[model samples]
Target chain A: MTGHPQSSMPGQKISIQASQLGKTYEHPAGSVVALRDLSFQVHAGEFFCVLGPSGCGKSTLLHLLSGLESPSTGAVTIKPTSVGMVFQEHALFPWMTLERNLSFILDQQAPAQQAANRQLARRWLQKVGLEKFQHAYPHQVSGGMRQRAAVARSFAVQPALLLMDEPFVHLDYQTRMQLQQMLLTLWQEVGCSVVFVTHDIEEAVLLADRLMIMSRHPGTAKTVLQNDLPRPRHLLDLKTNARFIDLVEQSIGVIRDELQAVD
Target chain B: MRMKDFAIRTLAPLGAFLLWELCSRSGLLDARFFPPPSIILYHLIMISPGEGIFRDIGASLSRIVLGYSAGCGAGIATGMVMGLSRRTRDLLYPLVAMLYPIPKIAVLPLIMLIFGIGEMSKIMVVFIGSFFLVLINTLHGVVGIARIHHQVARVYRISRRAYLRHVVLPGAAPAIFAGLKLAIGYSLVIVVAAEFSGADAGIGYLIWQSWETFSLKSMYAGLFVIALLGALFAYALEWLERRLIPWRDDRDTREHHDA
Candidate 1:
């Protein structure tokens, strides 16, 4: 049932490669080691989740991949193409209208496509159920709505690799579930590589094709686990599916052990 | 409730005026110094457009516009330079900090010597008054821009010109407008005081001339006009500010939703 063309290939194309990535932040008090000698690869059209506890550098890995920050000691390689990011903060330009926020990224097209790009923006906003709020400012919307807008904005860019740092972490459970499904649907439609960072084990299980778990205190990708949960998995179906529960429990067990080891 | 709010708002000033009128009419207060609101209004009308009041107002406005525009232009430019470039900020910030607190009135004697007690001197005084206020506020605004904004811009690979145009300018606008508001009030005060030191035509000159001749009523009229001008200036700035910061009022909605 996997109709995703890129993933259908037996030898999946490596879209992103990180090698010995390290980040150390220096403050007045002392130095803080964020990520140490981290390395990973994300396949084309893959939903790759980076799972870890807080300060375990899941976000640092996203940053390095997105080139939002330079690694202190390593390199990341990506197939030359457009990239989009949905930060935990949403980072929607508050001064702009929602339509304008999406257009700011979308409207970077040829003069002929300018009108089409705008229409595309409206279509994407409609997909996120924000068509009516296209003119509203960021502060005028609810947190869930703003996150949806942020998600819509990122997807509107039609990026080759979409890096998201727990975009739904701040939403309520119902909102989070709804957004997660919306994101998965959009991901399948776009077929772009995603490197989503989150701390929630259930979220990781729900969304990822495979997930990397990072160990705390001088963080490193401790393990990479595969999720063989069947495709087109409904949100409610995951609750009763034994394999889904097993995957979540396995991830939680590993994380718990890592937390204990760190202490 | 709305009507009551309006009534309450209107009555405070009206009540004060009535008490002042009673005090003056009953001879309980000195009319020479503390004239009733009616006597001040009568003198105000007598010195309206046909009289020298319009000329004084026009002269004061021209000086303010000229001085305030020059100062704001210079301040915003230099402040942006200081904000974006550390070298410039390091070089100029100390000097600005040292000079910012020195009253423009204190420099009037020196300015008069350089610009020679003419319109240039008065304008210079007003310029100095506004320049520091705008420069400091604009610098603070730019420096206070969130790191996340820069990260977002970089991640998007936005052009330097576009970043400045879209992000920096709008981000700094609220603080810049605040500075402008303060500058306008400061310019008004400085221009008036500068006129008093030496000027032939201005509200400050009118007030000074009236005081010298013991024309209490005209002095009160000049004061009233200046007060009105101040209110108008403040109201205009606030109106402009509201237009620039469209997100400000929406913050109430966000906070309400949060609660």
Candidate 2:
């Protein structure tokens, strides 16, 4: 399916582009293809979500875009931009405190602005409601809070592009909702392009400016749905809204069809 | 609960001491060889000034400290090389494997021949014992760190110095510290063995001298000090480990269980 370039911020410039991307991992037995012929572009300030079933190579796609993994077939071209990424495991330095975790990124991103980075680190921690926990190590905090810190860290760098590979997948439902809202609020403030990968249809519907539905294993972009849900979406309100449920069901229908086709 | 723990902790050792005293006093064991704790204490006080027990302790301690530091420094540097580079690991692993298991004291005669029967030979024995233990542990620690950290370092574009300082060091700290603790015990064993084989003034020399002269009480006193040193070193390292890696203790209970 082709992306319609549906965006919340109209006339925003292109932030990332990838064409005919593919990734293959070779084991002792043989080579396994993870992704193939996947093409997508992310607009500036756009919240682009990739939705797929597990093992669909949604993560491989994100890794390729973020330059964490190289595609054997094609290339990903970022628009001379800095990219920040959040992994599914939160991946905060276990040895460092929450403040240092954020400052580690900030200090590297803006070494010349040391004092400013320290202040920004504290402010970012506060934004995630973790100012009190700035001195606490990553292991000292709950799994949910660590992921919050991870989000804060990605946003703290002020990258033009952010790649999130199932950041909320390991979190429980309650923490997941809280983090999603926190992410949306932070994303609004930063206004960077985000390529969020998730298998959950409801999350894709809620967060995506344009959602790419991916087919199972050796994933290809099968459908691209433009989310027409109104802005400033809250989880509680969106659950009750008819249009929100319709969008969710429509995305679910696409995934359901893919599952049946696999059978 | 606290009272129960205290009671068990104190009573167990105290009870053992009382039983030992009773056995020795009642002539159940040879008093000459297994003197009562009080006699050992008395000999400890008598030898404190005349025989210079403190000087012997100082001598042994200096050897251990110097040897341990040198071994640790070399071990960490070599282990880093082996852990970070495949070529170094390939070159060093076989050599290390061949040398590591050979009892360090077996080479004491050789070390004495080369370095002479002075402090150098004793120190070298301790150094070899600690070096191999710490190097193997440090290598394992460095190699065992999760790949997630390497990816994180690349993604964030952390400087090489900062990556080693922050991520690599701390990630491998627990393992390295474990190695250090084990190395300390090994150091003590080798130093004592080296001294017993040949030395003028050390705890090991003192113990051997007392035994040769048939001063059983002083021998027991020396034994007491050696036991006390082992406990003290273990406690000291445990304290340092807690301070350095405080988060390890606070880590999730489930994760601790898994480990």
Candidate 3:
């Protein structure tokens, strides 16, 4: 499926571009293809998500975008700015406290600005409602709290792009909803392009400006979905909104069709 | 820890000592081999002012301290090299596996033969004992760190220095500390065994001399000193671990301890 330049901010400057991307892993027995001929572009400040069934290579796609894994074919190009990422696991440095976790990113700043980074870390922690736990180690906080810190850590770096692989999948339903809203709020504030990958149709509908539906293993894009859901979407309200419901039904239909085809 | 917890911690040792004292006094157990706690205490007090015990302890301490630090420093460096590279680990694994299993004491003769029957020999035995344990544990520690962490470092473009100081070291800390504590425990055993045949002034030699003359009190004194040192060292290590690895989640008790 081809993706036309979807609506983003007025300028719509490109943040990341992935063209004909593919990845294959070689084991002792044989090489297994994870993704193939995948192509997508994320506009600056766009909240994009990849939705797929299990074993659909969504993670491999995100990893390739993040440059964590190299694709056997094609390439991903990002704007000249530091990239930020979040994972299913909170991924906070276990030894550092919430404050330091954020500051560790901002430490890339000039030595003169370093003192400000510590204060900036505390401010970011405050934005996540974790100011009280700023000094607490990741292990010392709740799983939800740690994820909040992880989100804070990512956004604190002020990246031009953010890549997340099912960042809230490990969280409970309630915490997941809370984090999703908090993530949206942070995105609005940071104005960075995001590529969030998840298997959950409702999650993609809730968060994505444009959703890429991926086919089963060795994943290729099945379709590019335009989410018409309005901004500041609270889960409770989104559950009842007509547009949100329509987006969900459409996403489920696309994925259901892909899964049936796999069988 | 509360007073109750402290009391509970000390209960077993105190109870055992009391029971031993009672058994010796009542003649249920022979007093010759298993002297009462009071007799050992009395002998320890009498020997406190003497230079012999101090000199012996100093000799053993110097050897252990020198050897253990050297071994652990080298072990950590080697472990990092092996852990970071598959090639290095593959090259070194068989060599380590071959040397690690032979009891460190069993090779004391070989060490003494190479280094000579001097302080170097005693220290080498301790070094050999601690080095392999630290190396293996450190390698495992580095390997055990989740790959996601390394990815995070790369994604964020963390500096090489920051990556090592913050992510790599801290991630591997608990395992490294475990290795260190284990090495200390092994060092005590290896040192004593090394001194058994060597010409010298060490706690092990003191124990050997007392054994030959049938100086039961002095022999017990030597044993008591080693035991005391072991207990102190263990407690010190635990305290240090708590300080260094305060973030360590006692996995089993995480739920219970969560605020």
Best by DockQ: 3
How far residue B47's Cα lies from its native spot in candidate 1, in Å, is 4.1
Candidate 1 per-residue C-alpha lDDT over A101-206 given as tens digits, one digit per residue, 9 for 90 to 100: 8887665433357778778889999999999999998888888888888999888888989999999888889989999999998988999999999998899998
TM-score of each: 0.94, 0.93, 0.95
Error of 1 at B37 (Å): 0.9
DockQ of every predicted complex? 0.62, 0.50, 0.67
- Evaluated on CA atoms against the true complex, candidate 3 attains a DockQ of 0.67
Q: Candidate 2: interface RMSD in Å?
A: 2.6
lDDT of model 3 at position B39: 93
TM-score for candidate 2? 0.93
- Model 2 docking grade: medium
Model 1's CAPRI class is medium
Q: Name the regions of candidate 3 deviating beyond 4 angstroms.
A: A2-11, A109-112, A261-263, B47-51, B249-252, B255-259
Cα error of candidate 1 at position B89, Å: 1.6
Q: Please give, for residues B1-259, the per-residue lDDT of candidate 1 as tens digits.
A: 9999779978977898899999998899988788998988987896555558889988999999999999999888888889999999999999999999998999999998998988999888888888899999999889988887787787777778878988888888888988999999999999888888679999999889889988888888888888889988998988888987887665765778764
lDDT of 1: 0.85
lDDT string for model 2 (A129-214, tens) is 99999998877778898899999888888888999989999989999999999899888888888999998988988898889998
* TM-score for chain B of all predictions: 0.93, 0.93, 0.95
